[model samples]
Target chain A: MNAAPSASKEEKNAMSSMETPDAELVARVREGDRNAFRKLVERHRERIYRVALGMLRNPDDAMDAVQEVFIRVHGRLTDFKGESAFGTWLVRVTVNYCIDRQRRQKTWDARFVVDNEWEGVSEESPEHQLVNAQIGEALQRALAELGEEHRTAIMLREVNGLAYEEIAEVMGCPKGTVMSRLHHARKKLQVALRPFLEEAGERDLADRAGEGVRRRE
Target chain B: MNDQDQEKLSLFLDGALAPEDAAEVARLVATDPEWKAAHRALKLSGEMMRAPVEQAARSANFDGLWAGIEGRLPAPERAPSLLERLRAFLTPPVLVGLAAAAAAAAYVATRPAPTPAPASPSPGLAATPRIAPAPESALAAAPADASEPVVIEGIESEGSKTVLVSQPVEPGGTTVIWLLDAPDAAGDGAAAPTTDDDPI
Candidate 1:
């Protein structure tokens, strides 16, 4: 019995030595650990930005939302209640903020521009970059045309990689509804991107043909 | 493929299917040309959609993010992201307690005395009033209610698993709707027993 107690205590110590969890960090922030709040921000900023981008579509608007979302997250720290995963709450806040911003401003800017900051990050040839940019713009256009619920479902699935159960919780919908939305969203995107996809497919074939001739040479 | 099969294909690709369903999907993909084509199309579109978001994430400069937010943090917790800056030059073990504090002091002390931290323009940042638990956040933009209205209370109180209820919220054609999950066999939400499952 005494050994069992020691073993469990050791296990706890080992666990404590591992990386701190979001919940523990939440507690620390509540207790006024300023650095813990920063740790939380560092860990979750990218995902939150992705969520914002998925909702708002404009890079400038999304970038702005990162600070807003964190502000909301910190201000409402008590209401967090630990009822759901902190990530889920962050997503909820982001989505809600985007919704309010859209409603208040009435600016449905349909452009998802590949801004200047992304100019030369990759070593791909200029041709590849141009082609990818076109595809990216095309994808954004198609995503822009989807219904609000459908777009959110796709973003949560592809961007956050959320499961059906978790997504349902975040969206306040049923598991069946989440799956149905994802299916319909995929179908819509497939239709919208068909022309570009076919063109890309033909290019792949042509490239393979050129490679075959080069090999024969 | 029917909608059901299409949905299954999406789930299968996501690896969200159960073993039996996955095996079934795999078998169909192996034998059926239609399923194969559908799978390929869905996969391609998904990849195309994902590329820009990944590109955006890669190119984003997150370094000044904490600086932008720390200034606007609510109440007494507002302090510069001192540790965030320290982590740029120090390893994790060096971040503990008084040693970390001393190292941070030293790190700042070594910098030329009058040179302040660079004020990188964090775009879209402002010192605005904060709404805790964000009072307006709950008003998410949803699809406007369908034009034609049908009777819903009958289906809800009968066998449906979820229900939409509306109550008039004052005057100007604005109605509030609640989407409530059906309580157990107790039937009515008001009558369901509450449990003491508080995490606090």
Candidate 2:
């Protein structure tokens, strides 16, 4: 068997900054360390949840997908050859599980398709919370209208901040395919969200005008 | 505008375009109203799509997720079957060997037996032969040998055949079934090979 590749100097520095490196955690898990597995979950659960939510849409479904993903990860942990970053592998699992679940349901018209709901806004100002909720809802609605492949690409690119190549790997497609999917997805989202953007722009303009009046007074 | 222009604009929006191409797009966006509109829309859409992940921490159910995952985990020290042990040694390439062996075994096991025809056919006609599937109970009760690999074969549908092979690997680890395209099954594109080591 080939030796696991050594972490580069920059990678070592980055992992040193963290409480425990993912590779170390994975190694421990492989050796039957449940605590290490839990730690890995603690570190990556939020991002996994977000990716699940992006693909599955419904909060309950997303949560279920998150659980299924980790379970599959645990079952297949031994097979993880450490060929890629743990986060990349985990994200791939999450995306594939969500896609499978979505296919099973086969619902095209479902609402609440992706991301966090307008439940908890930590903003102190009620106005800010309301605006955020509105924008969030609008964005979710627009995302729901996209095709599965398009939505997956957009989520990987925009939400997870994966590079084109990483997105390609996660989606199991070529870089060019990823770009094309993102382009089409973005175009569709823009068309769907133009009204919301215009409204938000108007609201911003009105808010600025009110501030100007207060300053004048 | 055109497909090429749109793709270029998309690349520009994603910052994937080369510096020269980006500059060209920037000029177009500056000089062309349509390109500017498209750019603004794509930019806004990208921002909204990105917002969810940035704010994901605020909405994630971390405690619940951990609880769910922890509850479903199997015991780490649970003993695995001997077949499971053999599977660990069988890598992706070895999967094809197992598949071929399983197919050959299946053909030998399920091959039809010829019998002498009756002296005279019935007045009406000969009856068509029907193949019955193996009983589930029999399959379940059958004991698998630890020394030799086990092969199970059946038809999944009209045109598709399924063969399952269990082989031993190292030890302690559970059996993992790695499905691969059979050598003779290539170019059919019916079933894609998948292994636990590789992400599907």
Candidate 3:
């Protein structure tokens, strides 16, 4: 009986030590540990920034979403009763903030030029960097033209790689809604990028055949 | 493919259709040229988006983004956070002691220190307030108007000062009153209840 009590106590301690940094930091943060809070922020910032980029498409808006996520997380740390995993909560907050920003932007002019357009290479180097930039810009433009719900759903699924259930949770909707949105988003993207895709494919075939002939020679 | 067939094919290309439905769509797309072309386009778009943008946008000034977000956030109130509230709640004795020391220091500052009270006959036995029992007469004397209802009644004797006392009760209504006989005019009350407060 004595050994059993000691064993259980040691087991509890071991489990606690293995707890995630977010929960550990939360406990310490409640005790006013600033260092612990900084650690938590550092762990999540990059992933949060990536999620923001997927949703907003604009680097500036995405970066804003990232910073806001950390601040809001810090401010509301105490209210985190640990009901959900910290990453799950952070993803939800990041997605919601970007969507809210998108909603607000819509109220203004539709012609707001979101420069998802990145810098392109000159005609002098039209092969590697240029093609990549052209494809990126085309993809960004096509994505921007999608409706808000479709865009976010596609971004979460394809870009962020969140599960359908996780996407549903983040979008504050049902799994069926997530599936429908993703389906529609995929359809819209196919229509928007069809011309570019066909061109890319023709180019790919020509390049492959050229490479094959050169090898034979 | 008709619109409905086209829509189902699109979803299938992205792997968003249910398992059984997806199997059906896959069979159709494999055998049907038009459906195959449409699926190819959908698959291509998804793949293109999944590809990295190759380089980080040089125009993305993360510092500026941080500043903008900070500007928009309602500046935190200068007041302390909930953590501060909890710290204060936990250290009631420390605060009470500090307050008493401050009051004494202020009085001493105004008057003169009496040569440190001759070094206190015993250096180890520094003064600490104790809950002296209320005289029997005080409890027994029950105000002649006891019939009028005792507004606040409590056990003020033997280690039960107001700081250590529980809430008072009456026939009806509530009145906030402490159980202390009187503040120790000479010293400050330091040792108070640590656990008894949980009762009421």
The DockQ assigned to candidate 2 is 0.19
User: Which residue ranges in model 1 land beyond 4 Å of their true spot?
Assistant: A1-17, A105-110, A113-138, A206-217, B27-34, B77-200
lDDT of 2 by residue, A3-48 (tens): 1124688987887796788999999998899999999988788778
lDDT of 1 by residue, B127-198 (tens): 211112212223332334433221134123344443333333334455443333334422443421111111
Task: Report the backbone clash tally of model 3.
Answer: 0
lDDT of 3 by residue, B8-104 (tens): 7755654667999999988877887567667877765655554432133333445454444446545445567899988967697988898999999
- Candidates 1 and 3 compared: the better one by TM-score is 1
User: Which candidate would rank higher by TM-score, 1 or 2?
Assistant: 1
Stronger candidate by DockQ (1 vs 2): 2
**Of the candidates shown, which would achieve the greatest DockQ relative to the real structure?**
2
Q: Best to worst by DockQ, what's the order?
A: 2, 1, 3
Model 3: residues with Cα > 4 Å off, grouped in runs:
A1-21, A78-81, A107-138, A206-217, B2-36, B52-200
Model 3 docking tier (incorrect/acceptable/medium/high)? incorrect
| Predicted structure with the largest lDDT when compared to the true one | 2
Residue A44 lDDT (model 1)? 84
Model 1, position A26: C-alpha lDDT score: 97
- In model 2, pairs of residues that clash are A57-A113, A57-A114, B84-B175, B85-B168, B85-B169, B86-B168, B86-B169, B87-B168, B87-B169
Candidate 2, residues B48-129, lDDT tens digits: the string is 5555445553655566777788899987796778888888868888998989999999986886432212222223222222
